[model samples]
Target: MTLDDILNTHLGRRALLKSSLAGGGAALAGTLFGGWIPNVAWGADATAKYETPVVETASGKLRGVIQQGVHTFRGVPYGASTAGSNRFMAPRKPEPWTGVRDAFQNGPTAPQLGGPPNPLILGHRAPTFESEDCLVLNVFTPGVTGKRPVMLWLHGGGFAGGAGSAHSFDGNYLARSGDVVVVSVNHRLNVFGYLYLGGVGSEKYRDSGNAGMLDIVAALQWTHDNIARFGGDPSNVTVFGQSGGGAKVSTLLGMPSTKGLIHKAIIESGSALKGVSRENANKTAERLLAKLNLQANQVDELQKLPMEKLLAVIDNRGQGTAGGGPFVLAPVVDGHNLPRDPWDPTAPEISADVPVIIGSVNTEGTFFMPPDSPQFAPLYSLDEAGLKTQLTQRYGDQADKLIELYQKEAPGANPSKLFFMATAFPGDAIKQAERKFAQAKAPAYMYLFTWETPVEGGRRHSPHTIELPFVFDNPQEQPDEVGNGPDLQPLADRVSGVWTAFARTGSPNTSLTPKWPAYNTDQRATMIINDDWKVVNDPRHEVRLIIESVKGRAAS
Candidate 1:
């Protein structure tokens, strides 16, 4: 029979077939044809389209798509479905499959309370679906032969909601430009990931509090075992993330299990010096159980709760913080899994030898206070009096001093800009850098992204995730956020070069920018990344000190 007749018969039999040739009949037919069915083919176009790339992974063979010389694999499972009995528990290995599975479509995001993307994160798109079986990852590589550097990206949404499959995080440009293997992971999040059932549940649920992080550990293990097939060097892996993803990278640094798995690390904006304390974790657990009308002895019922019912626990709530503020759902510092805080009093000794690149944007706070939001609209148009009133409420006696210092740092700067800078200056980034430097075994490089975007009429000056498109060399993907100016591509080139350079070696020194120095307590040498890149010693030192002083005074 002809191929058309065969396909027509197959389709007639399987009316539920999807467009991607991902149906079970395709694999069944592969045995006869010696190849999987083409994604786009009929009678004449079948031969050319059937030449898609296939890679053998540890779990099974995955059929991926190749576009412009970049082999891209999406929705590749790293772990089993965390549904039913597996909910709130540590990740388990995925079962071995027989036939070639399609890896062309992106995986589902974790069960999260869905919402529209924040207007400030322009061009940002949420994943189309959410499911418990979200322990998947995507890989992009130039070719599946050479041992190129592998970069594992963790997406940001403060651990509550986000998927690595988001369009903004596509690794095509990064993989092609850097000639590296890029992997973006989709792990559990929100209540499904970090419900803190260790203390309340039975012995089997001991690691439940930090299950989300354990999912990442499983992904790392998968990478170590299977990344080589995707043209990645297992030894030269770099764990990098922005915002909550960055906090995850920080949390992984302290993890005993992550030793030797990660050779390099990068934290952008999100600096998690510590995790949710066990006491707080227990409290959150108690609150959740109380809300569910369940007792500690009946904690097993948590696994049976519907995903949407559990997600409603944090409904209408903002994203949780690394330090367990706002919402209680986050990675916990359970004694068994997390052991201790990642970087509280000191950097984790587990990753003492791992080099790190830590940084934040110039106006990180502007993201949270987008002009379009009604709650934050007033802050954008704040006068000097309003700034003083808000600062006084926060800093008390030290408000005027902070205002003076910020004004001196930026003459003619608006009150709203000053307020955001004062509040959003991530002290944790500096703390992480200093603590890493204190380790003495590995060097820590510091940077401050000062490149402003023309988005929202320049209201968001170097806002959070502004460096993301640049770091991924994907300015065109998020044109609204990064803008399509003449300077965008060049900046993206340099930024992405620095990141890939760090992944290739331990240092970020490349021809893309000038000589960057290691961060120290004295020099505090930080690379000011902008159109005119320059190394600045303690940039805005006085402002940082004054803002820090408020904390000191408040503590005193």
Candidate 2:
């Protein structure tokens, strides 16, 4: 069926049980992060008023609208307010509102300080409404009878900054195109979401270092209870995200409470290498208390302080980089919410037996490197002497193998880009890393977004999040040739088509797209995405093994 054709069909929802989240470098010039929001102009006529009526969920009733071609229900709280006394504690269910709460405009997002104007990332710097009562979710469901498969999206901002409402992430297209219910959420960010509070001695604040993750699981509960009313099948849900969201997805895969809630997952551009250790988490929490000149016993006093005052102290804790910090967070592995070091354990922790799909972009590192940092240029320009020093510092004594392999690949190429390629991209590496360590034994599928965007003067390679628009078929703001002229529609049709197929049957397949294979230790295959997409085994060659040969000896 044509993309919109599927939506008009109003597919029936199969009743079931319950289930389940980066971009670019730039030219050496001006790149405003929020620049691309308006560029994606759509005929999103507000004239379409939705009368979806109030959904009476177990927690409360939510009033939503069916506007602009999709049924949009916004601002539905999944958890209770994370305010004063509840601050830094595992989120509690929100009190049921007396009447139907308005579910119209986007809800208040988690408060997070933003980065500078990053050109490659459009709409990132746009003003996001923040709040303490931000544990809300927005859903877009096409049909309304039984439960359709649901896809929950996690936003990426490195755990420090990112609004769930970024224009690029609007789920309308995915819902309408995939004929599946789509959910996007807002939760606590930065210190509010991830500060380690183990030493606080309060059972309420125990999960502080990983509250963001808890909030995600809580949202899933809301979906399990209410998605059927929106024509979504609660039993077949898939969780996925990019960057921070990808990392969050991986974390959930290793969690216990989150296990049965989701059936499938996809991780885009996320790595499982970095997370706080239990001992280190406690150490960090104690250090914060010490900074307050208070004993660990005085931790309760922090609960009494206003959130605003606490945020100021958190930001000034001498821990941010100059490239305009966003998520000052790192998830906690406190033997509870998370049972062990996600990647060190023997198998996937949370839903190891579930199906999995994960991968990343080709030139993914181009996005994470700072605009004016020492690692700026690349491996190509540095002198032989300088290269040796950097290799030793980053790879330690194994610097020789690292330098030899990398030099053979690029010879005199940009080392910065090469390093990111070998060490970072193929996002599957980190996914596999987590998989290898997890006792979770689910089947896994993978892919790499190899399409290069049409934007000129920008980095030609597929940096980070460029795959988003194509994946969801987000329309281009200005008129060009495709949707509004500037869209990657043909590619979107193929990508989003495959994604919806997966939502429907846990396998992405269609006559128009290539037949994808499930990821396994044997073939170790992946779908190479582009206009001429193809599924290939042994993608990226020995780069995977070459990098793995130098594991733990990398860098922070």
Candidate 3:
């Protein structure tokens, strides 16, 4: 109950003095609480009768700040400044500005590591200033024209820490509750965005192991060339995120310069089935040039050494090991920039005409457990012989048939809530949305969220970023990870109306939830949400066949 007491109990006090007056007034009070103009009252000369708002773009003119009616624009700059020799190369663009620039603030935050002490794993509240000339972005719009429909977002910290100016990703409540145009970005992370250094020296550092996914493909080519002067709809954008920005929308649906620059995508709780295999990204770039002893023709003196000695050799080489070991930073299939393994073996016929949604969160390992472990506060008083001695010491000999199929799918559940709902299943984001609903030609939804944050006493279940302030309708910006509830504004108006009706129309059919369907491979339909939204089908189905028989015994 603190984050300024749930932002002064739901943004009051003249919307916190119009969000401490500036930086686009806290992104226009995080987009006027989404249900448009809920009670627009600002006085004390409403910051001397506001009026800022500029626009333009093909790399110039910005200004921004409208407010109640929504407009925003913080930090802007679509690329350039990955800092000195453009760090690990490949983002470029930006350099065009001339007048009207003052985009109000925010810009600077890709040099991470000021996060994760489990404030619900990365959705942490404070700390937003960092740098390395962080590529910048942030918009929020509701006007500049009428084309509309364009979301973008991406934040999550997995590619190595977040920042699309995270105040819980304030895109002013999904740009005035889906009038659309949101934006967000801030690129490059860990060792300046996945350092690979192909063959060490200079082939102009090839694609330096995907420079932070080509700085989200140069901010989707600057939202396909300046999102229609902020009114949006650069061919109906819609790339969403949650968890490492849903693994950067599953690596931009296997990027080929993101075919037609994204039509739609969602991905929450980060699915990312694979990447980082140019032989473990060139043996983690020759173990970061033998820990910066530097050779292979001194790889341009390893880009002139600083960035805190390449983040102290990626924090003493620990970024590599999720069981395959030795490849540090992420994103790198690199056969000409991520040539394979997006949804793994399929789903990338150049984003088979786009449309996707993916999901997760139902005790996502209680926001990645270990909050000062000693079996983390005795896993909420585990018994039944400490849940059969921690499920026969982690399922050896298939621990009594996986604790009798999760005690018949959660009965009196507790071996730390059946080990955080058997490691929060959405088995690799539903096997990458069941290989894009069995080879897409567009259309692949699926969801699970299952709300459970009654805050601490409920032990933050339904964790891993409890559906980002109910999908940015801003559940009062992390009321200490979503609490002060009036049952979370009708589940943040049915999860921001099924993500702005799947970004205008790729299909998330709103009117509060039901007929979702689409994810096929027979009845695997899903949707679940919570506070009563339905559409189930294979909801649990024996924990998806025991997580596909424990990943076929860990891929044999």
Candidate 4:
């Protein structure tokens, strides 16, 4: 059969057959055609249409498509299937193959609860398929010259939902604009990833609690060993992620195994100071076992049970509720695999040599706050008396002082604006960055996404995850989140340029924005990202102190 005929058959069968079976069929067909189905046989006109760029990986060869001068590879397996016995275990390297494999479509997303339809949070297009064997990654590169920097992306679903194939994360723009290689990964999540079966089951399940994180490490190892073939410099890899992905970056920093694997790190919005404590992890394990009605010795039954049963328990466990008591499906502080808290009492020493960039949005809480909240009703039209009442009720004894301080700091600010400002201080990112700045030999940079959106009548005001499209240089994918104003493209260019620059060098400085200085305890220099980017030293210092003081009192 001709190459077009074979591809047509493949596409039709792909919908009817399992992914593994489809891959196997393609490999068999390629072998029958002498390792490659030549596009030249179809004539000059057909050659251009059928031609695919092939790159050899450590495991096998892959065929990718070229579009607009960039070669794109999708659904490339970095690890073996995480189904059956492999479930809840560390990722294993995929079996090597001999024939060319087609990587034309995205792999299945990790099995997860359906997320909100809000495009601002979940992206414009959601994954069409999800399965247990979802350990795949995508790549975008200029060419296979092995000279470009590799920027690895980790998606943000808070360790539960999301995939690397989200339309908003498409690497075409970043790869072409920066002349760099871009990669995105998908791995185990939620119960399949972080279920603590260490003490409850066989020694094989010892690392179950951290299996999801290990999947990422395995993917990095693959990149280190194979990224060069895709025109990427494995030695110059920079790992960047938003929200849960940011937490993953933070967690990787503490891992000794990650030393020398990543040269730089960027944590956007998700600032996790610590993982689940061992005690809490054990409690969650106990709860899971009780829910399953399985004895300690019968933990193997977990592997035998259908994925639906486990997922049902996860749903009942309330994994992502706002007031959820404690996160059930999260990485645990296992002394062996995950030695200690990533940045609880202090920053990790393993990543002290790795330069870092950390920051958050201006109005993070707006994303989480319900529109129907009664407390926020006065924000639409608040007189001085109403402002005082709301501030007093929320801030208690410090209300009068905070109001005065905020009025002096932001003249002509309304009650709603002050509410958002107070709630969106990015305390977590700042606190973690402070910890790293105090001890790291390498320099650290900080930024605040201050560009508010006109979406939802301006309530978005730079909420969580708003900077992603800009950072990826794909602002058009999120017009609602970025607004229809003419200023977006320029801002996106500035943001993506700085991010790619950071990957190339340790610093994020570029010609577009002002000189961004490394964050230090004394100055606390921060870059405010907007249409007009500016550097502010210790911005809103008093407000931060007040927030910290309140947290201290609550903890005490």
Candidate 5:
């Protein structure tokens, strides 16, 4: 079979199978255990699909399902669904159920346009699931016991098109060896999640603009209140995510509401400093309601509208931020949900009490926008000269200086890699974000993933989310899961061990490796993960200083 067939083999097993609703019993084919070899053709073989597997939770006894080896739960509402009646409203508690709730399948995903399309996997049908009742969360736990550290994961689809059960977040190995609990959550997104109806005199949606964010907070509450049953700790939780998830974590750092909910954070190639403000959020909401010819009080009409029409309107101008791009749906500074731009508020200082692990890949902007994209007109015009001009406009005369810096170290870096780094690393208030927490005395640790894969042309050198498989210990590149071998397995074991150690004790001390120190503003040390690892001071120190000192003076 070809790559599609091979991938589909996993798609069917991982999603369709393990996600079967007979309480979600058929979904787990092999995605959970596939992390071992990273790239392994562990084809889906239909085995037993349990209607429900009992789990002892803090709230009492609970029964879930076992899909393949990975235990799965579906449609477990973290917050009340924001459907017809509750459209654009502050998240309310999901009703507790007495009878066993069928969790064989996942709940609906919030409506959105396809983000950074994964044609290889998500080629099924672009926009399918859409609804207001989308505030659901899923949990994947292994047999490991005794209050494991929980990894509360949020998906990345630009705050728009993604669900908690996407293929990439299989939690089997993470739960098994790391002895951690992994949860992927679903919340209101896009128009339904971000609509600012609070000023529209609508009682129902009085606190809307940041409803989606509130949904996330609600999920964390659920974890705190309920996660002890599946042999996981409610207190020792690490909130982590990629892209949009990273941005959310950043925003949460500044939200007084998020205090005491989580103890640690890990941001992978995403930051919210480049997100929405209250003014812009309200403006966007007004425009959306104008299209519907309804006011916030007309919540019923808005909720009743089909999800397709709703999303088409929300995405009218396309999904991304103007300075950014489409794959970043964000929270508005609603005062309640988000008080200010996370970077401007110095969340690092606000969350100084919480340990943090934040990083960006060498080339983080690649996967979201293809190198061959034509939409980047005016700048990346067909002509090379125009592209250079566009580059200069964005980076100023410093464009060449920036390129020189990247070229010096990343000599073999491809055009795509160059573009990605210049835009992301030290980009979008990241340098400032680091500075904020560094000044706050937060025990922050930093890193840069520099491994260029042998597959995918190696040009994407740890592009955007490449560190995921390494973090998860799953390499998805090789044909049919034929992999980079079990040699790297130790790395996963080691890193995850460090992570757990930190969660349990607040420091990543590993007897197997050298002592990982907490971050200090003076040294700014960072851990570098490659085939082999090293602890190094900032990799982009020179570039960071240059950008900081010459920022306003640089080109356009």
Candidate 6:
């Protein structure tokens, strides 16, 4: 059967279950489905209604629309356009306007080339619009009066691509459910955001390499100054993101400019330990200059060049992953903005007071291995011998030891499963959690999402970005990634509750889940979030041990 045929079959089965369960009440349905059943519908509570909401900001007044009891303001500018001389420079406050500006639709995404969607990863959509004038944010709130908690979401594109306007990131459900404010930001990215020009450029472009990070800082400042009008508590703001967005949160935690503006942080799947060094960033910039055949003094010519011309000089391979090359663009540890790596040797002292929730999914590797890709064909049906050979190519002498340990931990697991688990283990998430625990100033909560998605015949297995729909309480928003099963709403209710609770207080504990203990070196407590949520101490000890063994060998 074709891919569409397989998807339809899965949907048909789910529909049958729903039809059979319709006779029983929600409680009975919950009993049969292995989880709680939510009373609310996936969409709006009542008939969709739209009303204009005007909120004053530091810059000017913004007119937004309210639908289904949630006031949503989109395309709200946080910074000025970075098109001309502003290219590669720190973001500046938008010029004030006299009349109220309409924020009806999403702002432009950072100028990025689009790539074909990967069938393996669910809800894989590219940014709708691209431009240098993309320093805008979207806000969703229950009301524009009470001082509810505020959450700012950073979109993930690996510091290379992505925008806040992606459909999967809709904040209406999340904001209404938690009675909090949700903000999603769009900022400069790729060469426009991270290209380093400090060495060859004038004094004004010294902070060019870290302009994107600075844009996020600007967004935070905007929220701090203006979210109160949207009924959000600026003092109780939490920043959370997945994948590249998570790496941005990690970077923001270390930025001195983000002090006091950020109250809490959540790093999901993407844990960045360090940023590109100044030397490496400068070299990349020099290479780009050479590619353009421009002299040192003529650096201003870059600002005059067309956007297409500048983009063409670089290898704009595509988005899902950072482009493959020695000159991949990313944040720089510039002395001014970012003094050091975010979590290299240890957690940044600047964010010691900030409580954090750090976690990774069970199978992050599946997203990278699309079944149709010829390069990864062996990974889908690898035998024991093939697994050993594949592991040896990457792990060298430790391949046998890894195999023995993984088999001991997960007896009867197939060679493909074993290899994926052993290889895709997020050791960095553990290290980041440990570093936060070591800080001792703030509490750290840990979690592992092990819910295997039933989509694509269960091949994904809780892959990267799978938890996004649940976290946003919009499982119905992306049915492909999260199947349209009877259990989705309840799971989303539980997961979104955890996130909102953390934003409200500095803890993820809620009545929906069990009593989650703080992560420490002793118990290494972690909340295994799924249909049957439970707190587990060191969920994967073997994985940790294997990581330690790898480090030990590397050190020797």
Q: Which of the numbered candidates is closest to the native, going by highest lDDT?
A: 1
What lDDT does model 2 reach?
0.67
For all predicted structures, in order, the TM-scores are 0.90, 0.81, 0.33, 0.89, 0.81, 0.88
RMSD of each: 5.9, 9.1, 21.0, 5.9, 6.8, 9.5
Better of 3 and 6 by TM-score: 6
Across 15-101, the per-residue lDDT of candidate 2 in tens digits comes to 000000001111100111112112222223422223465677887776555544567675578898787788888899878757655
Per-residue lDDT, model 1, residue 196, is 86
List the candidate 5 regions with Cα displacement exceeding 4 Å. 1-53, 56-61, 67-70, 119-129, 295-300, 317-329, 348-350, 371-391, 412-419, 428-433, 436-441, 476-491, 511-514, 554-556
Instruction: Please give, for residues 421-474, the per-residue lDDT of candidate 3 as tens digits.
Output: 765667787777788877758878888887888767776568788888878877
Candidate 1 structure lDDT? 0.82
lDDT of 1 by residue, 1-556 (tens): 4223444565542221232233343233221101234455344345235324678998999877665567778778999989999998899999788977666556667877766557756444546466788899989899888899999999999988777877678788999999999999999988888888878777888888888999999999999999999899999999999999999999999899998899999999889999999888899898778877999999988888888898776674564463235457788998867889999899999999999999999888887776878988898899999999999998887789889988998797899889877887768899899999888999999999988888888887778889999999888777778778789998999999999999999999998789999999999999989987999999878767876787777679
Of models 1 and 5, which has the larger TM-score? 1
Candidate 5 lDDT tens digits, 1-556: 3222433555553444333522233233212222221223335433233434565443334455564455666557776656666777778887565644445455666666664554223411222444566777778776424677888887776666676666556565566667677888878777777776666645556567777778888888888887776667887888888777787777777777777888888777776674476667666666666777877666567768876788776564543465133222357776656666767635544576777777777756545544345753222222435435545777676767777787787787544456666666545535644665556666677777776554434433455666666565444432212136655567666666666666667676778566566666667777777666778776677777767656646534
After the best TM-score superposition of candidate 6, give how far the Cα of residue 333 lies from its true spot, in angstroms: 0.8
List ranges where model 1 is wrong by over 4 Å. Answer: 1-52, 316-326
- Model 6: per-residue lDDT, tens digit, 241-279? 999999999999999999999999999998999999989
- Window of ten residues with lowest summed lDDT in model 5: 29-38
Instruction: Show where candidate 2 strays beyond 4 Å.
Output: 1-49, 125-127, 316-328, 370-420, 423-441, 475-487, 552-556
- Steric clash count of candidate 3: 2
TM-score of 4: 0.89
Q: Write model 4 residue lDDT over 1-556, tens digit each, in one string.
A: 3233444565553321222122333232221000123323334454345335688998999877665567778778999888888988899998777887766666667877774466455453347466777888989898877589899999888888778777778788899999899999999999899988886777888899999999999989999999999999989999999989999999999887788899999999988999987788778888788877878888888888887788777674444454234437898898877899999899999888888999999878777664456855546566777777877776778877787887887787777777677766778888887998888688889999888887777765778888988898988767767767678889899999999999999899989999999999789999999989999998989888887888788789
Q: What number of backbone clashes does candidate 5 have, counting pairs of residues 3 or more apart or in separate chains?
A: 29
Q: After superposition, how far is residue 235 of candidate 5 from its true place, in Å?
A: 1.6
lDDT preference between candidates 3 and 5, better one: 3
lDDT score, candidate 4, position 258: 86
User: Which consecutive 10 residues in model 2 have the weakest lDDT in total?
Assistant: 14-23
